[model samples]
Target: MASSSFHAPTLVSILVLLLGNSRAQLTPDFYEDSCPDLLNIVQAQVEIAVQNEKRMGASLLRLFFHDCFVNGCDGSILLDDTPTLIGEKNAAPNANSVRGFEVIDVIKAAVEEACPGVVSCADILAITAKDSVVQLGGPDWEVKLGRRDAMTASQAAANSSIPPPTSNLDQLISKYAAQGLSAQDMVALSGAHTIGQARCTTFRNHIYQETNIDSFFANTRKPNCPGTPGQGDNNLAPLDIQTPTLFDNSYFVNLVAMKGLLHSDQELFNGGSTDAIVQNYSQNPDAFIQDFITAMIKMGDINPLTGSDGEIRTNCRLVN
Candidate 1:
């Protein structure tokens, strides 16, 4: 009689575990009941930030990409270093490159005021990125929510996982493929450069040494990004000179003209496997917008810690 009771309870427990895992899938209305005004709060804050500085829209979008790529959109990139935890902030690709943390803090404060501890920072990032796209004239898509904040951060993973600005075509394809993204997705996502700017140091080698770039474009950027070390390293240059502040197909157009600011940016159009996709995007704005929206949605689905796996962080910069 004792053994029978134990076996029955164990079977029930197994079933519960399976059901719990199945219910961890993300949905657009995940916070509908808990935080009815969640989307409004995020959109209002993001609009104000982007209105103050047009680049803030691009910064927020980049922040989402950095967070998602490093550790599956679990909000690990936002964590600050502690005695036991090394955060992704100081990673090579992100040390001085990533921005918009202050904007996220502002949005989180508004969310906490309304919903207290109900919303997760991961969801905040996903929504803010979507809002940023809309503010910058890009296509809007429903961002699936329910991701939890990571208790730990990985600087090593951030360094290795995130592709560098100097990546070649093959490297870029393989890097995105490792994250389950296709080459077409990579080309579409690269269109995000339409609004952001890169530091001189990031494109110095590309402008100075790469023969794939247009001579005129390379020479124009060289004065600000000198070949000599420590010279104009922090200078800023728009990634897409034609429409630097607008989210458009100009980035692909520039790539076709060999005017891409970074080596990685040019790699998509450099007679490689991604060349056809880049050509298609350059000639068709609607196609680029559709693929970009689909790619962003796919990227957001990367290895999230859902259900009870992680905690809802009260502060975006610190784990609760």
Candidate 2:
């Protein structure tokens, strides 16, 4: 969907936040009493989606990352453009990309029926990310819950906060650091790339102009990803060349081989501080999986809106 005009935050939104900034701690069983079926409902829907399309697991996981990075995991990424608020779906990094909203909508419907106003869209995203990873043969962690949906979304934040495919090592480290993630956490979390695909537009320059990439790998990618701007822009290329549908340590192995599909993916091991971490993960799948789980849970803790801060949207697409 095309983005509507951007909207600046209203004065009221600023004041309301200043008045109530105390956050409640998120817990693993936040919905045990109110929504006993919440986890099952989300897991079932996510499993179905991934079963239908293996790539969907990556998309759902990407959605959660995109949401959390911009505005701190408040479900602001799920908001739709209205007469007022500007949604993040059409932001620069997300426009024509960052999908799986329809899947999220379906999950929300099932959850609403089972628990009504108890669960939040923000919490749904956390669980969906975990379930999606599990469906794709990745390690699973107990997703902490009780996040509330944002009343407004920042398209500007979405554009700036999310690290682009072209990001370099330093830029990547700084961006992840800004979100309270250590550089080690950044590399571990990046292992999620093992199960995703990138559009040709995202990797065109990396394959053509970059020297760190392997020659044969770059040559293999060139035919599918034309050098000309806008040509074959949306063409698909697997993030992990060996097994794009599986969530494993192969992504780190690709980095070791200098075959990372995106510039940012290669940055993890490009003679930087994160190189050792990447190397270890490439050799030790157990270490990578454990660290990845640690990073996912850490990322989920970023600036959540708990207690009475935000609302539990009945429809994830629209505020009630």
Candidate 3:
């Protein structure tokens, strides 16, 4: 890791410089003049949300990931369905799965108060994601900002673009690669599961039908998630069996032991190209943290609406 000497701040600064001509010319100091207190405002609201529910940290992070994956790092996922506008909220991958929009709304209101209409909900989400990770004991990074909100969100794109829990190794790689992320980035981002919970509907088949899982791990989860389809499908289970509330490399460790809570997770360590990446992350926390931050910044660059392309929405759920 030649880039090990570079800190997250410096890495982000370089990215800002490199992307100056692209649509994602987002800067770490994007709000330095207009909304100097933007970071603090978002962080404070996120701290409050996470205090109420520790799971909110992971939910916020997942919201950012889902938002970025759909079209870009725009605030499309935060949009509410209107009579004419169909947002991504009801997308198959989102619907009842993606949580923390209410938390984002709270943060957006606070941000609007501090900075008025200068900030974008998309940028609020980016900042909140960093704060959420820090709240959950994960490494922090400088967040790139200056993205605009997408007036139109595609439910179809959300359904097709965001990777599903049942995805296999090849599907995972292809899905991420479609978004310009490398296989390494895919495995690194998957490490976020260290903190969140998955629905029984998402993992029922993995525990009951999968042979690669640990017997003990499967049994522990079985009592909670009924074997029959649609039964107890909404029961909650931690993605990381060991540390469900902490952000750490425990997810990769679980995959190595065949205790991954989802089929998509086990696919990473199932003797594929990503197996070595998973092993490296499990053994090297520093490496994992660095890669996760880098991948996050990279993912934030996807198809962003910058400059005169998109408007700064006063309300995240409704376009101005």
Q: Which candidate tops TM-score?
A: 1
lDDT of 1 at 103: 93
Q: Give lDDT per model, in order.
A: 0.93, 0.92, 0.91
List the RMSD of every prediction in angstroms. Answer: 2.0, 9.2, 8.5
Query: Which regions of candidate 3 deviate over 4 angstroms?
Result: 1-24
TM-score of each: 0.95, 0.93, 0.93
Ranking 1 against 3 by lDDT, winner: 1
RMSD to native, candidate 2: 9.2
In order of lDDT, best first, we have 1, 2, 3
Query: What global local distance difference test value does model 1 have?
Result: 0.93
Give lDDT tens digits, candidate 2, residues 54-150: 9999999999999999989999999999998889999999998899999999999999899889899999999999999999888888999889989
Off by over 4 Å in 1: 1-14
Higher-ranked by TM-score: 1 or 2: 1
Tens digits of per-residue lDDT, candidate 3, 169-277, equal 9999999999999999999999999998999999999999989999999999999999998889899999998999999999999999999999999999998889899
Output the lDDT of residue 116, model 3.
88
Residue-level lDDT for 222 in candidate 3? 96
lDDT score, candidate 3, position 130 = 88
lDDT accuracy of residue 72 in candidate 3? 90
